[model samples]
Target chain A: MRTAEALRMAVEALRVNRLRSMLTMLGVIIGVLSVVILVAIGTGAKNAVEKEIAGLGSNIILVVPGQVGLGAAPTQSRLDLSDVAYVRRVVGDPSKVTVAVNSGEPVRVGRVEVFATLTGTDENMPHVFDRPLRRGRYLTGTDVDTRRRVVILGSEVAAKLFGDVDPIGRQVTIAGVRFRVIGVYETVGSTFGVARDQEVHLPVTTAQRLIGLPRINGIAVGASGPDEIEPLRQRVVAALAARYPDETFSAVTQTQLLGTIGTVLGMLTGVLAAIAGISLLVGGVGVSNIMLVSVRERTKEIGLRKALGARGRDILGQFLIEAVLLTTIGGVIGILTGVGGALLIQAVSPVPASITWWSIVLAFGVSAAVGVFFGVAPARRAARLDPVVALRTD
Target chain B: MSHDERAGRRDDERAEASAEPGAAGAPAFEAIGLTRSYRLDGGVQVDALRGADLRIGQGEFAAIVGPSGSGKSTLMHLLGCLDRPTSGTLLVNGVDVATLDDARLADLRNRTIGFVFQSFHLLPRTSALDNVALPLVYRGAPRAVRRERARAALEAVGLGHRLTHRPSQMSGGEQQRVAIARALVGDPRVLLADEPTGNLDSRNGEEVMGLLERLNEGGVAVVLVTHDADVAARARRQIRVRDGRIERDT
Candidate 1:
C-alpha cells in the first residue's frame, strides 16, 4: 500500500480511540518533562555559582594567620604589618598588592549609631577587590600616609545613614573618632542571600589606631591577572614563611575554593539528572506494552489486510509509524509542560531554573529513539503473521 | 441420490470430455488426478479431495454444491489460490500451481482472484468506500485513481449512495454488496465466493446472488460454493461433492 494512505489510516485509527491514545502518550510526556526540568535546574544553579565566583576578583587571594586545628570552629587569625610589607616587597610590584585590615566597630552618622564592619586598606584596595566607587573618591595614598580619618560608606550604609541625601563630605564617628566620608560605594547585589555592599571603609593606620590593635586580623591581596594568581600565591607563601618563622599562615586563592564548589555542584546535578532519567525508561516500557496490546487487538484486522494483499512490510510500516507518531506528539507536549513547569517554579520559588535549547533538542531526540526501540518487537510480530491462519481466525 | 449413481455419472462425463479434442482458448482451471489430504491430531489422514478432475472455462458461471463437510470450501480455497492441492497437477490460467513460489502465489491471488466471504469480512471501522479501495491500494494504484475505481465499483453494485457508511451502520445485504464492490474493484480474472448469501434473509440473499450472476454475465469467471440446491441451480455448470471426491459434474 502507499505510505500516504497507510499513514492516513493509522492517524484515523488513533483518532477514533482518543482516550486510549492520550493515556498511551502520557508516559512519553512525563519522561520528557522530567528530563527538561531537571537539566534546566542544573544549568541554572551552575550559572548562578559562576556569576558569584566572578563577583569576587578572579585574581584575588586571602591570607589568614595561623592554621586552625582540624574540625575546630572558625576563629579570627592575627597578622602583623610586617607580614603585609614582606608580601609587597617579595612581589616586586607595589601597584599589584593591596593589604586590607578589617575589624568590627561601632560607628555613628549624626545621632544614628550602628555596628559596622570597618575595613582599613590602601588606595589599591578598590582595584584589587573589583570594588567600584559610585560617588566620591576612594582612600588615596596621601590619606593613608597622613593617617587621615576618612571613610567610604557602603551602598546600604549610605542609604540607611543619609536617606535620600548624599553621604560624601558627611562625617561618621567610629570607635570615638569622627571621619569624613570620601565616597558612597555602588550596590553589589546579594550572593547566596548575603548582601555584599553593607560595610564602611577607612585608612589602615587610622582603624588600627582607633581600635588600639597592635596586629591586623588578616590581609587581602590581588595578583596582576588570573594566570598570575597561583604563581603570586606561591611567592606570598614563601615570603610569609620567611617573615613569620615561628607561626604558620595559610594562603587561599579564590580559584581553589571556586573549583571545589563547582565540583561538588556538578556531582550533585549529575546524580539528580540520573534519577530523573529513570522516568524515561518507564515511559519506553509503557510504549512497548501498549504496542503489544495494540497488536493483539488488531490481529483480525491484520489478518484481513493480509488476505486483501497487504505485504508484510506494509503491516510493519503502518504499526511502526503509529508508534512513532504517538511518542513524537507526546514529546512536544512534554517539552512545553517541562519548560512551563520550570518557569513556574522560578516564579514561585527562590531556586533558579533555566531551560536551554540543547535540553529541548535532547529530550525530543531521546523520545523518538525510545518509540522506535520499543516499537520493533510488536511490528515484527505483526509482519510475521501467517495470512492463511489469520484469515481462518474469527 | 445414491452415491454409486452419482459416482458413475461423474466417471462417464470425465471419459467423454477426455475423449474429445481440446477446444481452442479453453478456460484456465483444469485439474488432473487432483488430491488433497489433512493430518488429524492422532496422525490419521483424511482426504478432502481425491482424484477430482474438472475443467472450468473463462467467463463461466459455475457452482460447486454439497452438504456440510463435503470439502466444497476447501476446493474453493484451492481454486482461488488460497491453498495448494497435494499430489495433484492443478493449472490456473495456464500456470501450474505447484511451480509457483509463495510470493508468486500471493501475487496470483491478488491479480487473478477476488473473494467474497459469507461474513462479508469488511474492515469494521472503515467506510464502504475505503474498504472497496483496499484491493486497489495493494495493487499500488495511485490514491485518486483508486478512489475513482472504488466509487465506480460501488455504483456497479448499486451501493453508490452508501459509500461512506461503515459496516456496522449498514444492513447485512448492504455489507455483502460492499464486499462484492471490494471484490470487483481490483478487476480480478476470477470472483470466488464461499457461501456469499449464507448469512442474509432470502430477499437479501436473492439480491446478492443476482448481483454475482450479473458480474459473471459481464465476462468475469464466477465460482460459487453453496449448500442450497436452488442457489446451485442458477449456475450454467454445477459440480456436487460427496465425501472428499467429486460425485457428479454437468
Candidate 2:
C-alpha cells in the first residue's frame, strides 16, 4: 500500500484505542518532561555564572593578610600599603595593581544614620573593580597623600542618609572627624547577595587617621588582562614572600570563587538526564508491550488483511508507524510542559531555567527513536503471523 | 441490477480476458497432484491434502463438499494461495503460483482472487465502506478511486444503503454481503468462499448463496467449500473429498 494510506490507517487504528495509546505514551512524556526541566535549569545557571564572570574578569584578585587557623579570622589590614610597591616591583607593572584598606562603622549625617561597610581605597579603585562614580570626583592621589577628609557613599548609603538629595559637599562624621562627601558609587547591587550597595568609601590615609585604622588592610591586584592573571599571581606571591619572610597569605581569583556552583548544576543535569533516559526506556518497553497486546487483540483482523492481499512488510509498517506517531505526540506534549514548568520556576524562585529549540528537537528525536527501537520485535511478530492461524485466533 | 453495473462487471471481465495469456480455454485455477503435510506436537505427521487434482473455469460455480476432516478446507487454502503445497504445483489465473515468491503470490491473490470466510471476517468498529475497500487498499489504489469501486461493489451485493454501518450493527447475512463486497472490490477473476453461509439461518443462508450465484453469473468464477448438501446442490458442479483426496467430481 502507499505510505500515506498506511500512515492514515495507523492513525485510525491508534485513535480507535485512544486511552491505551495515551497510557503507552506516558513513559515517553515523563522522560521528555524531566529532560527539559533539568537541562533548562542546568544551562540557565551556567549562563548566569558566565554573565557574572564577564562583569568581573579573571584579572581581579584579592590578597588577604595571614592565613588564620581555627575560629580566628585574619584581618585584611595586616597586608600593608607598602606591599603595593612590593607587588609592582616583582610583577614589574605598577598600573596593573590596585591596593586598598578598609574599616566599617555607623557614621552620623546630622542625626540620619545607617550602618554601612566603610572602605578605604585610592584613585585606581574606580578602574580596578570596575565601579563607576554616579557624580562628582573619586578619591584622587592628592587626596590620599594629603590625608584630606573626603568620603564617597554607595548608592544605598546615599539614599539612606540624604534621601535623594545631592550629598556632595555635605559632611558625615566618623569617630568625630568630619569628611565631605565627594562621590557616590553607581548602583552595582551585590555579588551573590553580599550588600556592596551599602558601603562608604574614603581615602586610605584619612580612614587610617580618622577611623583609627592606621594601616592598609588588603591589596587588590589586577593583571594586565584576564589572560595574565595566573602568571601575575605567581610573581606577586613570590614578592610578598620576599617581603614578609615568615607570615603566610592567601590569594584568590574570580574563576575559583564562582566555578563550584556551575559544576554542581551541570553534574546534576547530567545525572537527572540519565535517570530520565531510563524512564524513557521503560516507556519504550510499555509501547512494545501494548503493541504486542494490540497485535494479539487484532489477530483475526491481521489475518483478514493478509487474506485481502496485505504483505508482511505492510503489516510491519502499520504497527511501527503507529508506535512512532504516538511517541511523537508525547514528545510534543513534553516540550510544552517543560517550557511552561521552566517559566513557572523562573517566576517563583531563584533557580534559573532556560529552554532551547535544539533541546526540544533532541527530545522529540530521542522519543521517536525509542519508539521504533522497541517497536521492532512486536511489529516483526505481527508480520510473521500465520494467516491461517491468525484467522483462527478469534 | 442496473445496466451500468452489468456493463462495469462486463468491462472488467473483458479486460481480464484480454490481459490473461492463453486464457480462452484455460482453467481460472488448477491444482495437479497437490499434497500438504505437517508434523503434530509429538512429531506425528498428518496429511491435509494428498495428491488432489482439480480445475475451475471462468464463471464456473464449483463446490467442494466433504465431512469435517475430509481436507476440503486444505484444498480451498491451496487454491486461494493462502498456503503452499508440499510436493505439487498449483496454477492460479494461468500462472504457476507454487513457484512464485511470497510477495508476488500476495499480489496475485490481491488482483486475481477474492476470499469470503465462514466467519465473515469484517474488521469490527470500522464502517462497511472501509471493510469493502480493504482489498483495493492493499492494491494501493487512490482513496477516491477505491471508495468509488468499493461503493459500486457494495451496491452490486445489494448492501448499497449500509455503507456506513459497522459490522457489529449488521445482521449475519449483511455482514457476509459486506465480506463478499470486499472480495469483489478488486474484480478478481475467481472467488474462493469457505462456508460463506454456514453461520446464518436458512433464510439468510439462502440469501448469501443467491448473492454468490449472482456474482458467478456476472462472469467471475466461484469456488465454495461446504459440507451442507443443500448448499452444495446450488453449484453447477460439485467435488466430494474423502481420506485426503477427491472421492468424486460430478
Candidate 3:
C-alpha cells in the first residue's frame, strides 16, 4: 500500500475517535512540558551563576581565613595589614595581579544608619570588582599611603543615607569616627539573594585605623588574564601559608567556585529530568494501551483491508504511523508549553529560567522514540491478525 | 411441488447457465481436491472441506448453496484467498493458490478478485464514494484516479447522485449496491458475494440480485454464496454442498 493511503486511513481512524486520541495525547503533553520547563529552570540558574561569576572577573581569587564548607562564611581575620605587602612583593609578577582587602560594619550617615559591607581597598578596588564610580573619584594610591579618611558609598547605601541629597564630601561616622564620602560606586543589582550595591568602599589604611585592627577579613585579587588567575592564586596561597603558619587562610578562584556550582546544577537538572521522564514513560504506556484497544476494535476493518489486498506490513505501518503521529503532536505542544512556562516564570519571579535548542530537539526525539517503542506490540498484533477470523468477528 | 414444474425449472436453469453473458473464457478459479480442517477448542479436529472439486469460469454467474456447517463458506474463504487451504491444488487464474505467499495472495486479491460480504461491510461514517474507492487505494493508484474510477463505478451501479450518502443513511438495498460498486471499482477478474442479500427485505433482496446479474452481464465473473433456494436459483449455475463435500454441480 502507498504510504499516503495508509496515513490517510490512520488519520481517518484517529478522527473517528478524536476525544479518545486527545485524552491519550494529554499524557505526552504533560511529560514534554515538565521536561522543557524543568530543564529550562536548571539552565537558567547555570547561566545566571556564570554571568555573575563573569561579572566579578572570572580570573579573580579570594584569600580568606577559613576552610570552605557548604554555605559557610568566614568569621574573623588573623592575617594583618602588614601581610598585604608580603602578598604583593612575594607573590609572582606583581604587574599581573591586583589585590585588595575588605571588611564590613554598620555606619551612621546623618540620622540614617545603613547596614553595609565596608570594603577597604585602594585605587584597584573598582577594577577588581568592576564597580566603576558613578560620581566623584575613586581613591588614589596616595590616599591609601596617606591613610586619608575618605569613603565611596555603594549606590543603594548612598540612596538610603542621603536620599536625593549629594553624599560626596559629606562625613559619615564609623565607630564614632567620621570619614568623608568622596564618591558613590555604580549600581550592581541584587542576584542570588545578595545585594552588591549596598557596600561602602574606603581606603584600606583608614578602615584599619577606624576599626582599630591591623588585621583584615579577606583579600580579593584579580589577574590580568585567565592564564594568570590560577598561577596568581597559587602565589597568594604560598605567601599566606608562609605568614599565617598553620594554613589559617584559604584561597578560592572564581573557576573553582564555578566548578562547584556547575556540579550542583548538573545534578539538579538530572533529577528534574528523571522526574519528568517518569511522566513521559507513563504517557507512552497510555499510548500503547489505547493502540491495543484500537486494534482490537478495528479487527473487522483490518480483515476487510487485508481481503482488499493490504499486506501485513501495510497494517503494521498504518498503526505505527498513527501512534507516532499522536506522540509527535503531543511533543510539539509540550515544547511550546514548557518554553512558555519557563519564560513566564522568569517574567513574574526572580527565578532564572532558560530554554535551549537542544532541549526542544531532545524532547521531540524522545516523543517519537516513545511512539515507536510503545507502538510495536499493537502494530505486531494488527499485522499478525488472520483475515478469516478477523472478518468473522462481529 | 409438481414434477413437471421441477423439470421445467431445471431445464430453464440449464439454459441460463449456458447462456450467461461473456461466458466464453477459461475458469477464473478451479479447485481440485481442495480441503480445509479446523482444530477445535478441545483439540477435536474437524474437516471443513473434504477434497472438494469445482470450477468457476469468467463472467459467469455461479452460486454455491449449502446448509449451515456444510463448508460452502469455507470454500468461499479459500476461493477468496482469505484463508490458505489445509491441503489442495487450488488454481486462481492458472496460478496455484497454495504456492502463493501471503503477500502474493494479497496482491492477487487486490488485482484479480473483489468481495462483497453479507453485512455490506461498507466502512461506517464515510461517503459512499470513499467506500467504493478503498480497493483502488490499496492498489496504490493516484488520489485523482481513485476518485474518478470510484465515481464511475458508483454511476455504473446507479448510485451516481448518492455519492455522499453514508452507509447508515442509505437503505439496505442501496448499501448492498454500494458494496457491489466497491467490488467492481477494482475491475477484478472475478467478483465474490457471500450472502449478499441476507439482511434485506424480499423486494430489496431481488433488487440486489438484479444488480449482481447486471454486473455479470457487463463481463465481470460473479460468484454468489447463499442458503436460500430462491437466491441460488438466480445464478445460471448452482453448486450444492453437504457434509464438507460437493453433493451436486449443475
TM-score of each: 0.76, 0.80, 0.86
Worst 10 residues of 2 chain A by lDDT: A68-77
Instruction: Report the lDDT tens digits of candidate 2 across residue range A56-79.
Output: 534787776776333557654556
| Candidate 2 docking band | medium
- What TM-score results for chain B in every one of the models? 0.88, 0.91, 0.88
Looking at model 1, residue A297 earns an lDDT score of 80
- Candidates' C-alpha lDDT: 0.81, 0.83, 0.85
Ranking by lDDT: 3, 2, 1
Q: Which run of 10 residues does model 3 chain A get worst, by summed lDDT?
A: A92-101
Model 3 lDDT tens row, B184-233: 88888799999999999999998889988888898888898999999999
Model 1 ranges off by over 4 Å: A57-84, A99-123, A133-185, A190-273, B1-57, B69-71, B74-106, B239-250
For candidate 3, give the docking quality class from DockQ.
medium
TM-score of chain A of each: 0.77, 0.75, 0.87
Error at B173, model 2, angstroms: 1.4
Query: Pick by lDDT: which candidate is best?
Result: 3
Error of 1 at B141 (Å): 2.4
TM-score of 1: 0.76
**CAPRI tier of model 1:** acceptable
Candidate 2 residue-wise lDDT, B56-96, digit = tens? 88889999999998999988988988888888878786788
